[model samples]
Target chain A: MKKSLLFLVVTVFILSMVLSACGSGNTNGSNEGKANETATNQPNADKPKDKVTINLVAFAQPHEQKMYTQLIKKYQEKYPHVKVNYITTPPADYATKLQAMIAGGQTPDVFYASPENVSFMVDTDQLLDLTPYIEKSDIFNVDNVWQKGISKYTRDGKTYALPKDVGPFAYVYNKSLFEKAGIPTPDPKKPLTWDEYISIAKKLTLDDKGNNPESPDFNPKKIKQYGAGFWWHEPAVWGNGADYINEDGTKVTIDDPKFIESLQFVADLRNKHHVVPSSEDESSMGGYTRWLNGTVAMFPMGPWDTAAFWDLKFDYDLMPWPSNNGTWGTWLGSQGFGVSAKTKNPQEAFDLAAFLSVDPDIQREAMTMGLQVPNLIDMAKNDYLNMTDKKPVSKQVFLDVIETNGHDWAFEKTYDREWYDLFNSSVTQVWDGKKTPEAFVKELQPKMQELVDKSIEKKKKAQAQK
Target chain B: MQLTEKKKEMWIAYLFILPLLLQFALFTVGPMIFSGIMSFTDWNIVQKASFVGFDNYKNLFQDEKFWKSLYNTVYYMIGIPVGLILAMLLAIGLNRPIKGSKAFRVIFYMPAVCSLAAVAILWQWLLNKDYGLINYALSWFGIEGPSWLGNETWIKAGLIIMMVWKGVGASSIFYLAGLQNVPKSLYEAAEIDGAGKFGMFRHITFPLLTPMTFFLVITGLIGGFQLFVEVVIMASNGGDGPNNSAVTLVVYMFQKAFNYYEMGYASAMAWVLGIIMFIITFIQFKFQDKWVHE
Candidate 1:
């Protein structure tokens, strides 16, 4: 009798263990069904009576986390029946983490996404179409926000996400370094031409012995200071009116002569003119460090850098990028707040996304904290530009680029960036002076085009499967 | 009916191993089988898998980057032999009846226990072209060192140097243990036969150490081929290095799986790697009788 009792106990224990393992999934499914019933029965209710809990996932800095926490507190108070759980991940791992959650069937109600991820997310049906939500939203009118920010997420007639912020990459010069060199501070309204910019860079660059680049006795190897430290090739390419891809993203156009010339000019900044740090020098002490130490005269800055730059020992201000033909250009970065397709409460999810993205009060608070440029055009011009106590005295430069000059980088427009990554990895030879830009571009264009073609095929397959 | 003694003992043993068996089946065998099936499909993790009928394998065979990464992985294996030889020498040196030998052994073993991520970061700063300690020392001899991590030709050599520094200690410890097991009677017999120290090491000591050498070689080759973390953290441009020179096979697989979302292709590459490793290990075991004393 005791032996039989022991065997039965053992079997019961093992069975319970297995059952409990499967029980969690069942509970989740039931809860989801409950949420759906509540959502469908009261589709038009302004405030849900039943308790609704939503999850918001995003990558955030410490200050941004605090801002969101405060915003959520306010939101919960407004709708007492709603409870929100804000989950954060490091920015570098955010995409993979979010995708893993979706694959595991535990997608967040609202999440953050980048412009580069929009097409892929939409193709995989991971993003909820926000068109109907936006069309009916009183606060989220299309005319109120920057079209460039909104249009990045729009495809065909549907929008997948709403713009969280628009960040413009602008030129920032160290006031101390320029003043010590006896050069006039760059004019906020007027941009320098390429030739003028190069001349200024030459004057600003000095060896350890204080001899400028143009001086006969100057030595390139023992340079104590660099003039300009622009590392990205996007500005040079776009300012020269040459792009990596054609419109509609069908062809790779990096083989264009104009593109080759712009790329070679960037290389010449180090190899020929000896104005900027060489690749080797930059690796040892990065350009950012050099700028912080007052060795580099000018470097690119974005709106997200405003808070960090405030604590600098030296004064710095923004200016328009050097122009190629009376037009300056740089890359604009935008991250969006998106609703997950699997959310049971689309209305609640869209409301949270809309509040975080387009709420002017929250936007103003974020802007005041130097977290981002305002998404609302009126607020950006009237409020953000009027904050004179903020450094980067020429705040108008950020607006100028956002309003006209900035563009989505070529890689952001593509379904996948493998082709661009290939280009970037192979072009080091050109940057290192081992190959001519023209030869390198011509040789690599075919390989890049092949990858782009493969990406197109993959995209088509995904769409067909959907 | 009452249970018999044998049946009771067997039941107890089975109950004790049940948890382990369940864990192994769920975590290891389940994923292994799923990934094997995934290699033959076009699954991107988020989407439903579609059967592609060996297309992933076919495409992997033609991929130039795959070949380059495989070549890079094999090139890094050159460090294994070089590391083993140095380790053997260090072990012999530490085995001598010399003062501070205990301190020296502890010092050598320190790198093996250090966190790999931290070690990779340290090496990154040490291999910097203009300001690195290595280059700074090279400058004293009036020889300008090439950029170790930045230059395409030198990145692998730089990585190999770090790998050897981090790995040589653990192997030496293993060799030290093996050295203790060498029978003293054999050395005494060699001395009686009028053999000198070198002669004894060549004939007796070296032959007896063959089993240990064989073990280290087999394990070293396997570990060297999966080199990922150090290369990813040490090399510039998100681990691809300049001109894709430092991309090892595992790093490429990781890139495809995570960065590019080509999980099916990554799985196919992983299976190919596994088969190659199995074949190489099997060959090693088959040929072991010729050299291993045991």
Candidate 2:
């Protein structure tokens, strides 16, 4: 009896293990089966009697996901024969997960494309060139989209994706803090020069002893509040009329005297002027939290963060980026939807992408959610910036920056991820005050130039093959 | 008939083990060999892979970031000894028949069982420079705390402290089990020989616990070399800490693979790390017999 019992227990254990393995294997098999089924259904999709399924994936926050689901439902109603499988991945894991899926040959029919990933996707032939689709469609017009948003997804004069949103960096200031310090609120119409901005920042900054930074007895060590912070170097550099790369993008000009001076001015905000929090302080609390807590007077943020900032207890408003040489500037960030090259239904995928990007109703819904600035010029102005109930009180500043001062970074066009990794890693030292900007730029310029040159060569080689 | 029954049972056993063996072969062993081959190429996931001979390895040798990451990984191993000592001491203290020892054991082991991401976030708050619990406590004694996560000089030390806090409880449980296995008669014998508490621990209890020590040290070193999650959580903006102080070998490899899409370079890094781990573990096994009690 005991011997038989042992055998029975052993058999049960083995059976369970085998059953679990088969369970996982079955799921993978089913996925592959579905892919094959989709492929077969594509050709028959043109027939009025046949049904087709298209897979679409995106990374979105909870609110944004709900909006996307609603939009997809509307699209399905219009195209009753089409079945859509919408997948949403969280932003943190989206890139890695999408890359794995594409590499494994289960590419989504449509997916989100950002400036960072577009070049890689194009080079690998993962994205379908949408130039022909746009040219043929009566509803889709490339000129209707903002030029800034369109340029981000274009390569070699061919558009690959339609812009879903355009995020222009603008100055966000705590109005309550400025009022408390007895300073006049900054005018959105007039851009503050560097000295004027610094003087105001000095007044807003306060030490534990309630002394301003300009006071002779001000204690930097016991600072209770900071005046301002610029999140990225681009705003400071561009505001000072210095570009990191020359206009032609042939070489890095980070070593330009104007750029170096801008860097020093920013560094002095912490070290010498004592009007801004040190890097350590900023990392600990974050600029947004500090602004919400009324510890910071001014911070630069994109439109995407406006929704989150809406809940702040203190009064706040947006303004155009401050000017240095009568030219205000900030970086423009754009995200859009692209059709996959491996997609079985290119027409359906393009339809979905175009609908998500250019449709006025969907863009208005996104603006209402405070998710993004509308990518369409007319919609962004008439529907969003001119909206009566907008909370920020200066929502038009975002549109203004996009229309006048916004530009893409030099590396965005030619350099890939490797170049960015090199630049970001080296620049952190300068940000942390471990190295002077002059020394850092001088030492890193050659390395950055080499990466740019290598990228150009690789692009030429790929073009030759094509 | 008896021989047939024996053969049938043998077949059943193999059948039961087959699933587990197959899983191990498919997931673990398959990836290992594939990655080994991939390490010799110049492949980004999207691009076509081309055979580049030893170029990936050659580039790794010249990579300054690789060297810095290796240094950071080794530096992180300092937590092992610190963790082991604290665990052993706690285990010894708790081994005594005392009030509420069971509850204390559970309380201490809580951190080990808690979700790693949650624990890391908790530690970030605790180590915050301005209004954190540690600084708050320090202020009462008229001492200001240094910026734990912000300053490069203290970031590694801060990470080590967190590791010890999280690991000590689980490690002490292992020591406690080892302590239980030790014969009570040895302590009686030592007492009869007029041995004091220190003498008894040093002579009788300590020798018996060497096996557990050996186990923990070897495993700890392996775990130490792959430190990624805690640093990633603490430094969420950039996975690399201020001035790249907290970038370990595994984290760098992850950035290379996922962020840069350099599969070939990442694979080469993984193999290099694997070989280093093998050598170290081999050396440990060779030397363990001298100190580890049977």
Candidate 3:
């Protein structure tokens, strides 16, 4: 009887162990189901009474993060029944992390989309078309925002995202450097022509012997201060009335004579004119550091650097970019909020995206904090240009560029990433003086066109399948 | 009854090991098989994959950049012997009964454990063309230092130098342990027979250290081929150095996968790299008996 009892006890213990393990596994499976059901049902079934939680993600700078946090708080107070989980990722890792999250099926309801990413996101069918929502919104009028900013995110007559900011390039000049060089600052309203700008740059540049480029005894090797710095090829190319792509986005036109002329002029600034820092110097010291040390007189910068520039010890002001073809011209950068197509509550997500992007108060705050140039034209003209406490004396330059000179920053709608990579890699040779502009462009044009054609074909096939 | 008891105990043993076996199958082995299949398809992560058998490999064979990157990777491996020599010398120096030998070992090992990103950043500043400490020191000797990181001809050499400096410590530690294992009696017996220090090292010490040298060479070759982080950090603005001179096979694979969204091509490149590594390691093992003592 005792042996039978012991056997029964052992059997029961083993059975209990197996049953407990299986029971835990079943609970884990059910827990996942509960999470899915809650995520799906709560936003739709109990919309009137229960809170609707929506996740919003953005890659924001420090000041932008602070502005977004405040705006989100104001939004939450206005809509008590809606809960927003705002997430911010650093700019460096934002795209990679967002792409992984999207592929892994954990899409955020609303996210920030840069101009470079708009076509990719749209091509992948990740974004919700905002045209319907925009038509219904009484306050969100497209005409109120900068047209370039709005058009950047629009494709095939449908808008994928709302314009949050417009970044137009302008010259931010150090007043102290100009005074020290005994050169007058260029007028904000009337930009200088290329030759006139070069003459002024000659006056500003100085060698260790205090000889300007125009002086007979000047030595390029002994240069201590550069007159200007071109951060990218955009301002020069656009100012020359040339572009990388055609209007229909079907061809690469980088081999145009005007574009080659612009590139030659840029190369001359360092190699022939010796009025700008060499590539090695720029890479080592960086443009910002050179500007801070008063070694550079004029820097072509976007409006986003206004706050950082304001803290510099030297006095500074803005001016329109120097014209190459008798017209002030530059490129426009835009980034805005986009809603994901995978959202359960499309209406609420669209509302949050609109509030974050189109609200006049948020736009004004973003402008005042130097996080953006206001996307709203009226706010940009009146509030941004005439702000009482801002350090820039000529904020009107940015607005003027946006109104008259800004073009969509030379990116094609299809095959943009591939074409841009090729162009950028090829142009490095031009910038490094290994190849002339004409030779580089001639070699790059056909390669870029092939990619564009392939992308168009792929897009057509994708559309046909859909 | 006894057989039943043994059977139950065997089942319990399997139950304990099942978790580990399941983990290995799910995580490691599963990805290995999946990646092998993925190499034969055209996948861009977001799109559905279609079979494109052998096309990726064919394109890889014709790709100029792939050839260039492979050349650069082999160029980087030239540092292995340079590193091994320095490591062995340090190990011999430290193995002696000298003051603060323990502290010296710790100091040498520190760089091996230090963060790679931090090391790369430090080397970047040290190798800068204009304002680097190295150039400043060279200036004191009236010699203008060449542009180390910027010049295409010098960038790979610069990388190899940094790799050797960062890796020598760990390799030397292994050599030190091996040196300790060489019986002291052998050294004493050789000395009593009027053998010089050099002769004793040639006959007794060097022969026994062959196994350690063999281990270091095999591991070093494998590690040399996977060089990525240092180049990435040093050339963060653009991963490709001047004229793409610093581009390595793994770096190219990463760029293709993440930046260009060409996952299938990247997978194929990865598989090719894996095959190359396997063949090389197999060759080394085959010849191990000629050089390495038991």
Which parts of model 2 are misplaced by more than 4 Å?
A: A1-49, A246-250, A450-466, B1-17
Candidate 1: tens digits of C-alpha lDDT, residues B1-294: 245767777777887887777778877888878889999998888899899989999999989899999999999998998998999899999999999999999999999999999999999889999889999999999989888988899999999999999999999999999999999899999899999989988998778888889999999989977989999898876778888999989999988887777889999999999888999999999999998998
lDDT accuracy of residue A111 in candidate 2 = 92
Error of 2 at B20 (Å): 3.1
Clash list (residue pairs), candidate 3 = none
Which regions in candidate 3 have their CA more than 4 angstroms from the true location? A1-33, A36-50, A457-465, B1-24
Query: Which candidate achieves the best DockQ against the true structure?
Result: 1
Across B52-81, the per-residue lDDT of candidate 2 in tens digits comes to 899889989988789999999999899999
Give the range where candidate 3 chain A is weakest over 10 consecutive residues by summed lDDT: A457-466
Interface RMSD of 3: 5.0
Q: True contacts preserved, each candidate?
A: 0.60, 0.42, 0.25
Best by lDDT: 1
Winner on lDDT between 2 and 3 is 2
How many clashes (backbone atoms < 3 Å, residues ≥3 apart in a chain or on different chains) does model 1 have?
0
Each prediction's TM-score versus the true structure: 0.93, 0.93, 0.90
Question: What tens-digit string does per-residue lDDT give for candidate 2 at A46-97?
Answer: 5674566788889988887888889889999988868888999989789888
Report i-RMS for every model.
Answer: 2.3, 3.5, 5.0
Which of candidates 1 and 2 reaches a greater lDDT? 1
Candidate 2: C-alpha RMSD after superposition: 3.2
